[model samples]
Target: MMHRTQRQIRTDEPSVAAEALSVTHVTHGLTVEDSGEGFAFEERVRGTALLSLESTRCTGTLSGAVEPGRAMMIVWVKSGSAVVDDNPVKVGRPVLYRQDPQRFRWVDVQHDVLRIDRTIVEQVAAERGDWAPGPLEFRPRHVPEGAPLAAWWLMVRSVAQEVLQGPADVPVERERELARFAAGGLLTAIPHWPVGQHEPVMASTARFARAETFLLDHATEQITVNDVAEAAGLSVRGVQAAFQRHHGITPTMYLRRIRLLLAREQLEAGDDRSVAEIARATGFAHLGRFAGSYRQEFGELPRQTALAARE
Candidate 1:
């Protein structure tokens, strides 16, 4: 197949999300707008692709596009702050994010823009074995600002913008390699659990692994930290520390990611299901709370998701 060039189209109507899929081809672009509340866009993507989006104004949540055969690396390109799972991320330097294939993320995006690339990253990650863990949900733990991986990503961002200007002579494999280099730097920066001055703690590792497995298997049910800790034979504190050390978030936030992901699948499929029905089906029992979280997790509300589905 011939290499496809990225395309950009602007719309002012709240109802234009329906047009995203007709393009068929992959995309990379920037969105500039003023809305206390942000927005969302979804498209099918395969192969390695890169997208950089930086906002000059606005702060909101971003959700959607989590599925198998897809991978993304998102960076914060603006100078400001956004709350991830209620945790604030200071902006300016880019934040590396991987989408969880089995779940959706409630990314706190500030006025800063985001850069995203799809399949090419998966291929590079395949070599590293870290890619198969599924899309990463949390920011990779603290790596110094000028790390090699960070520098490489900065380069990729420049190249992505160039490709947008005009078709380049670079081969697809070369583009793929560039993506690989970026992914390599990112994976290396992820913080490992139980990393301390001592050896890996068996008690901590086992507890964390068990809790993670339980959450993945039972995301559809109403669950709590106590339940997860009991199931994993660990104390609540232990489970919390494990997630914090490895993923940089609490267990509850992780579960919310799973719940939102299920809701997104229904919303994107454009099924006959109602928005409220989707909320309940996904284990969100309260309509108001569900709508608020859904909106916070994604830049748009549940109704918008259903509306996009109909399109």
Candidate 2:
């Protein structure tokens, strides 16, 4: 299940602030230097076992060395400036920090950090048939810039607000999907592989048919692209290509369409359930989004459909 945790520290003592930072960040050898009398630190972290979204803000100068851990760390400085490993990081620029010890200094900085397990990255690489024998390596500092950077930030915030903020008892399957979503976004936003190293595999019509069947059969359940690929006997990339070539949409979109249809049916049938209930029953976790998408697809809100059915 996904979980959310928060911590805040406001104190004049540097030791207190340093302790908070080390505990929250799971860092080692963290030291606070010259806090200038007092500091405020706060962090909100929400994630499952595979990925974590951390938003941290510090209202004073903090400097320390962070040892490289097993997870891949991606950070975006939202407001203030920082220097990592003597490389100046600008506001709104994404930074991939991993595999090496990092010396950092932050002055009144607000940043969002994504920690994804290395195993998840490797699994994604394997799904794309891009995995080599050795450990997967990503360019340490090559993150998206300009419009791509904006898009990546948008994706991160969306997942943080929409998906990760859902009910704590969210199914394990949904958590897995969430992890994969984060991993996929990171892989897309960063440069990990050679541009033309892997050729795209063409998926046959039969494979697409099988995938479609699997989606229809399991539309209301939480499932990942990996499940679809397995059902279609194709790689994840292969299943995605199959969907795009056949229906001009991705497998996830197709599955969402099916769920929307199911939700509409339940609404129109006067199932005696609330709109939110029907939404969750049909695999929509966020009610506002469910209502919006329902309206867009059917030209009426879910309540309108149920009201008409009752009349």
C-alpha lDDT of residue 31 in model 2: 66
* Weakest lDDT window of 10 consecutive positions for candidate 1: 194-203
Best by TM-score: 2
The models' CA-based lDDT, in order, is 0.50, 0.69
C-alpha lDDT of residue 14 in model 1: 26
Candidate 2 — what's its lDDT? 0.69
- Candidate 2 stretches with Cα past 4 Å from truth are 2-12, 34-38, 132-134, 194-311
Model 2 clashing residue pairs (backbone): none
Clashes of each: 13, 0
Model 2 is weakest, by summed lDDT over 10 consecutive residues, at 196-205
The C-alpha TM-scores of every prediction are 0.39, 0.60
